[model samples]
Target: MSDEPDETPRLDVPVGMFEDIEDLKSQLAQLTALVEARTGGDSAETVEAVSADEEEPAGGDAEGEEEEWQYPPFILLLDPPEYDDELRGLIEWVEGVLVPGYLGEPSADAKWCHRWFEHSVAIARLHAAWLAWQELTNPVSCGNTGPSVWHRDHLDPALRELRGAAGPFAGCTKGEHRVEHRLPSLVPSAWTHEDGA
Candidate 1:
């Protein structure tokens, strides 16, 4: 109610707000020191002032900088079943789940590499496929395009080649029909017949 006009600016804040102001100032000072140490004090202030969005070049130079192609890291199964059980599980999973789920109804014309599960290559491929399935189906990791990407990039091609007519199980069939087949060996034969001299 004094005639003299108030000079101090009034601020609306909690009563104890000033008590934490010193602590906040101490924290800010420590953070600034840490940043200076990490950056060697060279242009640290400039780096801090520049926003992430504003850091990029505003010209075609940015476009010219091509990002290096990065393949996703291969993730192996945590507890792969024992060899015999592994093979059985793999075959069961592929036949029961992957095949029907991804490729739809198994065609009589297309043959699955029946002996495919026996080979190391098939094991590796199936393992990769299983990992991809896990990643795409997982709620936390599966984003909007994850499923489509998995189908396009991994599932379709693998299933197609795996079920191709001339694939690993070329002569094998889903029916009871028996087909004699054996993988050709690359090593030269050690046995040589003695020539009659």
Candidate 2:
């Protein structure tokens, strides 16, 4: 092993170093943005070079420039305003990218709800798919096979469930929007309550 001045830098980022999922997600998002901004192309695969000291500056800039909402864009967790803001972005991707690029013909058997946001399950699942798309499509993290992996692992299952007969859009048709789509019933509580104490 001849050491002729090794160039590639490395760091040992501790597992579970963050306080919560939000913090981890925030750091990752910041890192990805910084890499994208600096590199300008999809070649920055050496994420280990980012020193712990350098981490804060990236995150600091993100706080001022980007949205404060660091958590996963889960539909239910967000307030009305945040929901509206996030949903708008999600819809843009869904319409511009997912629907046009990914989806095939929608038929009676393979359904798609016109009013998808109204259905909670669809919103949740689609949001998850969008999130996966964002991450997997990024070249820095996933490389060339990212989209393929996303299609196989994320998109396929999501679409299968979403477009299937028993999916959230089961009642809806190609031309007609179902007025009311009922959610699956929850299992009743097994514990029995005694007389008022």
Candidate 3:
């Protein structure tokens, strides 16, 4: 067993298996906004580092060779012993599986664990939000509005992003892990609106 300390982040909202329709819509909207925010608003992280060779200096320099391209800074993800081995792999994984997937990429090659981890995080967030929304909107859990519900759309973009990076994950159907309980279906086609037009 890998003693990864929860290798996942907790969601900030509560969720329900069967939520009211309006509340469900609300949850969907929330998911949409959150995903849109996390995905860096449509731009994507590049894939250069993942494919780079050892002799290929961080950049081309006569000191090896080339021009410089700058990227904005953000918090780094890992902080372990081997910065190169552990860190670069994570950056690539995030770039490949998690980041690309959430940013609305339209493929599906991200591995199963990647898909599973991202979905679970979103679910946890939805549930957390549901809890908070309930407190503010329907305090006391009055007669008609027990607890607000969650929508799956909010989580769809991330899956799409992952799909674009990797492609359809093969073991996605297996159901023998804790994370499986939290995955939202990745079938975007199934939610298309009707009018037959």
How far is each candidate from the true structure, as Cα RMSD in Å? 18.2, 10.3, 24.6
What candidate 2 gets wrong by more than 4 Å, as runs, is 1-69, 184-197
Best candidate, TM-score: 2
Candidate 2, residues 74-189, lDDT tens digits: the string is 77788889899889888888888888887778887788877877778888888998898888888766567789999899899999998998888888887777736665466656
TM-score of each: 0.44, 0.59, 0.18
The predicted structure with the larger lDDT, 1 or 3, is 1
C-alpha lDDT of all candidate models, in order: 0.59, 0.76, 0.41
- The TM-score, computed over Cα atoms with residue i paired to residue i, of candidate 2 is 0.59
Q: Candidate 3, residues 151-174: lDDT per residue as tens digits?
A: 133234444433343323433443
Candidate 2 lDDT score at position 128: 91
TM-score order, best first, reads 2, 1, 3
Best by lDDT: 2
Model 1 misses residue 35 by how many Å? 25
Q: Candidate 1 vs candidate 2: which has greater TM-score?
A: 2
Error of 1 at 84 (Å): 4.7
